[model samples]
Target: MRRTSARSRISRALAVATAVAAVAGLTAYQGVAAEPAARTLAAGSPEGYGAGTTGGAGGPTVTVTSADAFIDAAASDGPLQIQVNGTIQLDDMEKVTSNKTIVGTGTRGRITGGGLNVSKASNVIIQNLTFSGSDDDAINVQYSTRVWIDHNDISDAYDGACDVKRASDGVTVSWNHFHDQDKNALLGHSDDNGSEDRGKLHVSYHHNWFDATTQRNPRVRFGNPVHVYNNYYYNNSGYGVASTEEAGVLVEGNYFENVKDPYHLGEADSGPGSLVARNNQLVNSGSGQTGGSVSTPSYSYRLDPAANVKSIVTSGSGVGHV
Candidate 1:
C-alpha cells in the first residue's frame, strides 16, 4: 500500500474545512435549517447494496493531470486514491483496477475522448467528474463488486453512460447527470448470459438526473431486487427504465416529467420481467406496463418525496456538487 504524502494530507484538510465553512455560511444566509445527518447519504455517499463499498479510503492520494499519469495511477496495485485535476484525453476506454477512488478536483476534472473500464475489479469509487465524447461507454463495470458511481456529469458517449453487466454485484449509481445521449444506463449485457448473471447484479439507482436521455434509464436483465428510487426524468425522448429477461425491479418515488414511457416490464426481443411501480409521480407521462413479482431490498434507505425529486436531483447532481 502506498503512503499519503504530508502535502496531500494538508491540502485535503484545508479543502474539507473550506467546504464546511461554505455550507454553514450558505445555510445561515438563507435562514434555512440544515438537512438531517441521515440526508448525507442521499447523494454522494454510497448506500443500499453498496453501503459496504469503501474505495481507497485509507490509501495514498495522488493527483493526475494527464492521461499517462491518470492511467498509471489507476492501473497501480493495492488501494489508491487518484484525483483527476484537469481534462485527461484518451483514444479509448482505460482500465481501473481494484480498490481505487478516482475523483475529480473541484469541478475542473474531466475525461474526454475516452472512458473508464472496471473489469473484474472490486471496491471502486468514481465520483465528481465530467465525462464526454467517449469512444465507448463512459463507465463500464463488468464482473466487479461493491462499486459506487456518483455525482458525475456524463454525456455524448458512444454507448451507455454507465453499464453494469456480467455479474456485477453490490453497485450503486447515484446523483449523476445523464443528458444528450442514447442508451443512458444498462444493467445487463445480453439476454443469454443468465448462467453468469443469475442471482447477481444487485444494484441501487437513486437521485440520478436523467435529462433528455433517450432510453435505458437502465435497462435491466436478470437482476433481482434492483432498486430504482427518487430519480428525476425530464423530457426523455425514448423511455425511462425497462425490466426484462425475468429480472425483478422495484421502481418507486420517482418524478417523471414529459416522459412517454416512465418504466415497463419488457423491451425489444427480451422477455417480460417483473416490476412493481409505486408512488411515482408522472406528469404528462404514460402509465407504464408492469407484471410479475419483485423482491424487496434488504438494506435501509431514506426516500425523498416524489414531488420534490425534480428539484432535489437537479440541484445536487453532476460535478462539483458533491
Candidate 2:
C-alpha cells in the first residue's frame, strides 16, 4: 500500500468530518431521543468534556459532512472531536489521520460507506460510534500507531469488522460490540516488514465482543503478532482465533459460545514462531461439538506450555454443538 504523508492524512480526516456534519445538521442538531441533560453537557464535567490535544486531550468538536472536510479536520495540529449525525459516504477512504477523536450518537450515528481508513497515522482515538450496514469494513488501519477504538459497534461489514492491516502498529480495539460481521473481528500483525512480497506489520486487538452468525472471530496473519484476551464471541462459522499464515500470537482468557469451529493453526510457517494458543475457553452451546487442530510445538521454539483445559460446565465441543 502507498503511504500518505502526515499533512495529507490529517487534511483528509478533517474534510470528511466537515461534510458529515453538514449532511447530518449536527452543528446544532439534537438527538430525537436525546435526554434534556445530555444536550447540555457540563463543560468541565466528564460527560461532555471536549477531546484533548494530539498527544494529550482537549480539542474542538467538528461535524462530518464532505470527505475532504473530514480529512482536513482530522489532520489538524490539535485533537478533534467529530460528531456524526447522518451517513458519511466516501468514494475512497484510504486517508490517514493523526491525533483525532470521533464520537457518534451510539450506533445510530451511521457512517455507511466510508470506513475510517487510517494508515501510518499515530495517536488517534474513535469512540461511541456505530458503523452500520457498510459494503466495506466499518473501520480499517494500516501501518498506524497508538490508535484506540473504543465502544464503537460495527456490524454487517462486507469484509472484516476492523482490520489492523499492513503492519499497522500499536492499535488497541476495545469494548466494541459486533455482530453479523464477515471474516474476522480483528485481523492484525506483529513483526516488521518481512519482505516486500508480504506486507508491513504491528497491531493488537483486545476486549471486543463478536456475535457472528456467519463467520469467526479473528486470524493473526502475515506474522502479525496480536494479543487476544477477555473477549466474548458466539455462533461463529470459524475458529475463535487462528494463526493463518502469520506467527508470534498470544490467545488467552477469552470466552466463546456455540462457535462452530474452535481453533486451527495450520498454513502458518513451519517454525513455532507462527502460532501460539493458550488459556482460551471455547464452548459449543448447541449439540454440535467444538472441532479444531492442535499440535505440540517444535522443541526448538516451544516457549509457552500449552494448557490442557477441563470442560467447564456442560460445555459443547464441536460434537453436536453446532
- TM-score to native of every candidate shown: 0.87, 0.64
lDDT of 1 by residue, 1-322 (tens): 1123433333443344335533432121111111111112212459888887878765555566667667666776776677777898978889999988888879888999999999999999999999999989999999999999999999999988999999999999999999989998999889999999999999999999999999999899999999999999999888999999979999999999999999987899998899999999999999988888999999999999999999999999999798
Candidate 2 — what's its lDDT? Answer: 0.51
Runs with alpha carbons beyond 4 Å of true place in candidate 2: 1-56, 65-72, 75-78, 94-96, 186-193, 196-202, 222-225, 267-274, 285-322
Taking the tens digit of each residue's C-alpha lDDT, what string does model 2 give over 1-322?
Answer: 1123433544544444445543433223211111111121111211101112232144445555444445445555655565555556555453546766665543445566657787667767766666766667778877766776666667777777787766565555655677767665545443343452143344444456666645535666553345555566666765566665544455655666777665555434422235455566657632322223333221121112112222321232211121
Write down the lDDT of every candidate, Cα atoms only: 0.84, 0.51
lDDT of 2 at 283: 72
lDDT: worst 10-residue window of model 2: 41-50
Cα deviation of 296, candidate 2, in Å: 19
Q: Model 1 Cα displacement at 235 (Å)?
A: 1.0
Q: What is the lDDT of residue 90 in candidate 1?
A: 77
